[model samples]
Target: MTDISTSDVQHLAQLSSLQLDDHEVEALRVDLGNILGYIDQLSELNTEGVEPTYQVTDLQNVWRDDVIDNYDLGRDELLALAPDADSNQIKVPKVL
Candidate 1:
């Protein structure tokens, strides 16, 4: 069994910025310990010369052709509906 304790779980929660009650912390400790134990057991397996699998799905080039969407909208007509405008142009406060 993993040597995980309630204090360890509390410390982990603190590090992760999680707020947990005493009961929640206790449950998390047991759950996390089980997970850690499982990982430790897997680590004992001989993986020498075994190919590491990054993803199970086959790799493919899923791409789309580049295209321009040209909508001929008049600049003056669009600018006219603005809440504020200056000299045939839409004006807003400088962001920077």
Candidate 2:
């Protein structure tokens, strides 16, 4: 079993930029200890000839040729449809 200390939890929280209260710190210490213990248990397994599995699903990426299509509309014609335009650019209300 792994022994996780209070300082270990505090150091982890500091590195992660998390402001944990005392109660939460205690909770996380136990949780981290349990996780490490489970990992230790897994390390005891023996598999001499087992093949390592990278991905379970036999999925492959499908690719398609890139095609560009414009609906026959000119730049100036599209700009004219906008409610507000200035210097060949559409104007929108300021955000934030």
Candidate 3:
């Protein structure tokens, strides 16, 4: 098991822009050491034949053909449904 010093915890807290109290610092010291020890245990596993995968779902880029439908609504009718319209186009509030 790895031992994390209080100074190491303080340095990590500083890098992460965290303000930890005395009790929190001691708690994190033990937590970080346990995390590193778990990682050390994982390193001992045999993974020589394992294939690297970016996603576990095994799905690739799926695409479909574009089809346009009028949906029984004309351009003028769609524009009229909008709360605001100008010059035969829908007017939306400016975001910027």
lDDT (Cα) of model 2: 0.92
Worst 10 residues of 2 by lDDT: 62-71
The residue-by-residue lDDT of candidate 1 on 1-96, one tens digit each, is 587888899899999999999999988988888889888978778999999988777867767668755467777878889999989877899989
Pairs of colliding residues, candidate 3: none
lDDT of 2 by residue, 25-65 (tens): 99999999999988898677897899998887887776656
When sorted by TM-score, best at the front, the candidate numbers are: 1, 3, 2
* Candidate maximizing TM-score: 1
Inter-residue clash pairs, candidate 2: none
TM-scores of all predicted structures: 0.50, 0.47, 0.47
Better of 1 and 2 by TM-score: 1
lDDT tens digits, residue span 1-96, model 3: 589999999999999999999999999999999989888987888999999778878678876568777878899998889999999988888979
In Å, residue 30's CA in model 1 sits off its true spot by: 2.0
What is the full ranking by lDDT, best candidate first?
Answer: 2, 3, 1
TM-score of 2: 0.47
Name the regions of candidate 2 deviating beyond 4 angstroms: 14-17, 47-51, 60-96
